[model samples]
Target: MKLLIIAPEQIPVPPRAGGSVENVIHQITSRLPEGHRVTIVSLRRGYLPRKSVSGPVTNLRVPGGSKKRYLANALRRVKGLAFDLIQIDNRPGFAAAVRNAFPHTPIAVFMHSMTFASPPMTTRRKANADFRHADLIVGNSLSLQRSLMSRFPAHRSKIAYVHLGVDTAQFRPSGKRRRGGYRFLFAGRMIPRKGVPTLLRAFKIARKSVPSIRLSVAGGTGKAAYRAFLRRTARRLNVPVRFKGNLPRKRMPAFYRSGDCFVCPSQEHEAFGLVNVEAMASGLPVIASRNGGIPEIVKDGRNGFLVTRYGKPAAFAARMAELARSPELHRRLSEQARSDAERYFGWQLTAAKLMELYAERLKTASAGRRTK
Candidate 1:
């Protein structure tokens, strides 16, 4: 089968910078079945060739001035190419444009978030049209699927859920935990929706019980004001915190290995917490909020604990303290976390499931054409 993937304009495929969508595209394409051919279309800055082949995937770079213009140019460039399926990654506008341009081709729009599920009139109309045109709408988690269904009940039959997977081989356990202190790590944007403030307050409270406990945060400093606010909150609480800004993707394994436990205190309805899986694959116990698809990934008392209430610092703190105080429990969760990641979440399984979906959709389309 021939596959064409439309990636976000902000980042490149096999992302040098941080982009979950691009990373996922890379993961799926790299692990595709042996007989398949894949091509990726993305926006690149400055003057670069319009088309080129990178490794096994053909990359077509469009100008990055405007998303609408880029999509228009991308469609023009791939006008004559033949592809069995067109898979778009989390861009409703692009999906709509591609569906219009290639009416005969089967298009799959993969939704990573509920950004378009709820809206203020105009957005809903566009999102509805995008979903209505696509042959299938793939959600990365069941939480996202349910949200999409609630917002657009008419399209529930077209919606499907597929869990995101991580690279277990690269994020595997290092067989070493920090001595003398329990280190808790958080890796993501430093923003309110991520529940950074809640994590900070929880850390402060946990420190009261376990003084040796430490917290490290690593991610792109989203807003300058948010970074300042986080720093001030950390000092005001007198909790020992380390802020490592924008760690590279290559260094993430070491970052995960350096910690005793992983914490994802997300207040927003996260579609799927990829970091939680990465940390679990690193053989670290995870403590995350029971929001969105997090519950699907982090099973409470199995891999780690989940705070049921959102923004409850006290509950989060209690979980932190429990893991810090009990070494046997921590070890048990750590082992289970890695085992779970290996058993269920891997790129190979993700690719296989996707291929099965693609094949099914193509077969049904062919049958419809025969009947027509």
Candidate 2:
């Protein structure tokens, strides 16, 4: 089968600069079965060429500017090619444009979240039309799928989920024992909704008992005000929280390795926590909020601890302190964390699931043609 995959315009493919969606697209396209040929379309960035070929896979980097211009450039570049299926990453609007170009081709809109399917991003009528127009709606999590299904019940049959993954081989553990207590690591955008302040509060509470415990945050992708707010909160709490800024994808494995335990303190519902999977793969147990699809990834007292009191700093502090205090418990959880990622969250498994869905779509389409 020949496939055309569209990465979001935000980042180029082979996403060295850093974009999870771009990373997911790169992983999927690179891991397609030998029989399949794939072409990945992404925004032209850095020194990368407009087009480059590597065996069965082709990469097309289109120009960036406005979202409208990006889509136009991408669609224009692929006008001559015919594909068995076209998958658009995270943008429902792109499906319509591609549909206009290849009206008969089966189009899959791979939504990472309900961002595009809801208002403020796009109008409700537009969202509904976009959902109806796509041949398949692929979500990254069951929670996201459920939300989409409820929002567009009429089109529920087309919506499905295939969990995103990490390259366990690359994200493998350092195999080093924790020698200097637990260092809680947070690696996401520095935003209000991410609950960084709650983490700060929690860290302070934990540090009160475990004097040698540490917290290192590895994200700077937010407004200056928000970053300042986090600094002020940390100063007021009088805890020395290390802000490592945003590291590129290549450096992330090392970033994960640097910490003893990983913390994801999201106040809002996450569609899926890829960072948690990354941390788990790196053999660091996760301590994330028990909301959204997090519960699906993190099993309480299994891979890591889940804070049921998601907003309350005291609850998060209790779990952090418990893990810091108990080396035996952390050891058990760490081993299981890596094992779970290898078994369930590997990119190979993720690619295979997506391929299965695509193959099924082609099989049904072929059968329909035969009947016609």
Candidate 3:
């Protein structure tokens, strides 16, 4: 099967920068079986070639001054190209444009979150129309799938889910740090909804019980004022936190290994926490909010603890303090985290399942044609 994957216009495919959607695209395309050819259509960024080929995959980059321009450029280049299936990443408009170009081909709109499917991004009428046109709708988590199904009950049968994954081999466990303090790591944008302030407040409280406990924050961009506010909040609370500004994808494995535990204190409904999977792959226990699809990944007292009251600092502090004080619990959770990542959350599994889905869709399409 020859597949064309249209990545979100915001980021490049071989995400030299950092983007979860782009990373997912690159990982899945790279791992697909050699017998099945793949073509990636992505926005040009940095020094990536306009067109290139590697193994069974082809890279096609387009000028992306704007989302509109990106779509125009993408559609123009692939207008006459034949593909078994087209996968549009996180954009309803792209899926619509692709459908206009190739009406008969099977199209799948992959939803990484509810950000694009709801009000403010696209309305119920427009989103419903887009879903109706597509052959399949994919969400990265069951929570996201259910949410979409609820919104567009007419398209419930088309909405399916597959969990995102981490590269376990690359993000292996590191030797335990002998530093006196137990460190917790946070990797993501330091935005309000991300709950960086909440984590800082929680760290401050956790430190009172375990004085040596520490926090290291990695990843931040586009919100300089918010970043400054986070620093001020940490200082005013008398908390000592290390802030590592937006590190590239290659450095993330080491960043994950540096911490004794990973904390994702998101105050919002996270569709799925990919960073938590990366941390678990690195053998660190995860302590995340019990909202959204997080409960699907981190089981309480099994692989890690979940903060039931995520918005409150005390809730997160309790979990952080629990792990900091108990070495046996930490060790057990760490082992289980690594085991779960290897056994369940790997890019290979995600890629295989995606390929199977595409193959099945193509087979069904071929049968329909034969009957016609």
Best by lDDT: 3
Write candidate 2's Cα lDDT for 1-372 as tens digits.
889998888888987755878888888777777788998989998789888998888999999898889999988888888999999989897777788898899999999877777778898788888766688899999999898898888888899999989898899999776567579999988878789999999999898899899989988664888888888888888998888877887888999998999999999989998999999999999999998888889999999999888899999999999999998998999999999999998887888889899999889888989999
Question: What does the lDDT read for residue 163 in candidate 2?
Answer: 93
Better of 1 and 2 by lDDT: 2
Clashes of 2: 0
- Candidate 3, poorest ten consecutive residues by summed lDDT: 172-181
Q: What's the lDDT for all of these models?
A: 0.87, 0.88, 0.89
- Residues 237-315 of candidate 3 have per-residue lDDT tens digits of 9998999989989999999888899999988889999999999999999999998889888988999999898989999
What's the candidate order when arranged by decreasing lDDT?
Answer: 3, 2, 1
Instruction: State in Å the error of residue 36, model 3.
Output: 1.0
1-372: candidate 1 lDDT, tens digit per residue: 899998877777767757888889988888877788888988875445667675667878777667888788778878988899999888866776898788899999888888644464238767887778788889999999898888878888888888889899899999754676899999997767899899999998898999899999998865898898889999998888999998878999999998999999999899998999999999999999999999999999999999998589999999999999999999999999999999988988888898888889999999999999
Q: Over 4 Å off in model 3, which ranges?
A: none
Root-mean-square deviation per candidate: 1.7, 1.2, 1.2
